[model samples]
Target: MRRALAIFFVFISFQVSGQGVLDWWDQLHNYPDAAGPDRSRYINLSPGYLGPNAMIMPSLPNMTIDNEFWVQALGQTHAGNGDKTQNFFLKGNFPLARDRVMLYITSVPYETWEVTPETRDERRMMGLGGKGGNTGDVAYGVIFKVFREKHWLPFNFGFRLHTKTTTGGNLTNARSTDNSLYQWEGNFSKTMIEKEEEKLLLKASLGFVTWQTNKNRLPGGSNHNQNDAPYYGFGVEYLNRSWLLSSDVVGYTGYLGNRDYPHFFRTQVQYRFNRLALRTEYNYGLQSWDWNTFSLGVRYYILELLD
Candidate 1:
């Protein structure tokens, strides 16, 4: 009789525990007086819809190309708003026509992330929580530059066409948007001062970007599927034979406003020696984003050209 009573008690305990778990899940996900969970009410289809890389606006590139073949690897950390992310970035530049044209690839190959309880509840409500590690998108582009001395224009003119692929995974964990994006940018730069070992430059950029978003019902009851933005940036850079420093303000404005707009102040410093460089970067998010980020990396030049 004692053995039978023990078995009954174990069964009852399991039943209670299971029900408790179910109730908790329902509290996180269930919607009252609705056909089912209304996901549209929970996710806004903005930058916050996925990971940091989901809808990032491209930063302005310097008019000076690397003039050789080189590759870079970096580790980055982003922390804010009760969430944290760690990721690795890999990039390579290939010269297509010496100093005037190049092709490059930049990739966020892997990341691990964690969100706060409040963030988790929203993700759970949309059935996109319970994720940890995943890969991010890959961007490849072509850059073309026309030197000031060689052209009739007073400033060096450059152009870039970048496209990001939907190679990322783990949408359930909100690790990536799993969507493609495209950008077209025009850049202008002029040398304000020059010496054998030191130089100063002023640069500006304007671009447009478009990407797909989760189909969401707009306030006007219209369903939207894509987002488009116009991006702009301006910066100054100072460089010598051994060191480079730059700072820029970059951002984009989308049609939806608010969370759809993101701006940042970015700064970078680099130290260079024979065939190698050490680099550090910081970005302070402004306007619609609260996350700030830092990164450290090294670049190795596989081939170089000298004048």
Candidate 2:
């Protein structure tokens, strides 16, 4: 594990070096705003605990992506179960009618899951004992932003509809492949504090997630009791020119009852250098079945390539 991490770091260093060269060229040419797009608009789009930026249980507004493709590579470690997961994400934004309506797509190329001894034992009890290292399912989704940011009374509101497809590896036993789901969210964000290059923002979101279950494919033929759940999240972010620090306490109540709800706390820090970003985050699950996770990742925003 240590060796693999070392190698990954080496690769990141090389990528950063290449990005630095591009940065120098952009500076020399005085590239238009398209080349060095405004970072403030996307600062809150960083990935959250479960691999997407929806806070703990739901996604909320941060910044809007205009015309860009964003790529992310994240390495995650789950402590309680001694598991490791790696994720690669690709996202693109296309203007349907500029800010009024936009189409966005996000997809996970693939994820790798490494099971620990403890997990193996648990699986063995369920007749699934085997070595770890399995490729996870590929998931892709599309987001339709219904409206641009609008001031409604004291808050700015944005609405979106998103749907995810379950396409990839094993979707049954290991659960690395999840069920398909649809979500509709209303997001609100407000600037609470502002200074020269420093600002603090508050964000909140409410949504409903309806899940599609495949009970026949599950191990032991157990019926998935998942019901439509209400998702809620609250987050705060402090941003400076080159630094971003944020924390969120978010969760959802199960449709069944209070006992079935899941909650989590997440924190993240990011450093930006031109168009390259380095980030790290930690998440603590507040529920019985949830696992605590830590992740390190990097993001590169390509504004001119697709434009």
Q: State every prediction's TM-score relative to the real structure.
A: 0.83, 0.65
Task: Give per-model CA RMSD.
Answer: 5.8, 18.6
lDDT accuracy of residue 207 in candidate 1 = 90
> Ten-residue segment with the worst summed lDDT in candidate 1?
214-223
Q: What residue runs in model 1 are displaced by over 4 Å at the alpha carbon? A: 1-44, 123-131, 146-150, 218-222, 305-307
Evaluated against the true structure, the overall lDDT of model 1 is 0.75
Model 1, 126-198: lDDT tens digits are 3334337778888898989976534788788889898988888766455666678888889888889899999
Off by over 4 Å in 2: 1-59, 63-68, 81-108, 114-128, 137-152, 214-226, 257-260, 304-307
Q: Write the per-residue lDDT of candidate 2 for residues 147-248, one digit (tens) a residue.
A: 334443455566667666655444322433244556777776677887999989888878776653323322222135344778778999899999999898
Best by lDDT: 1
lDDT of model 1, residue 223: 45
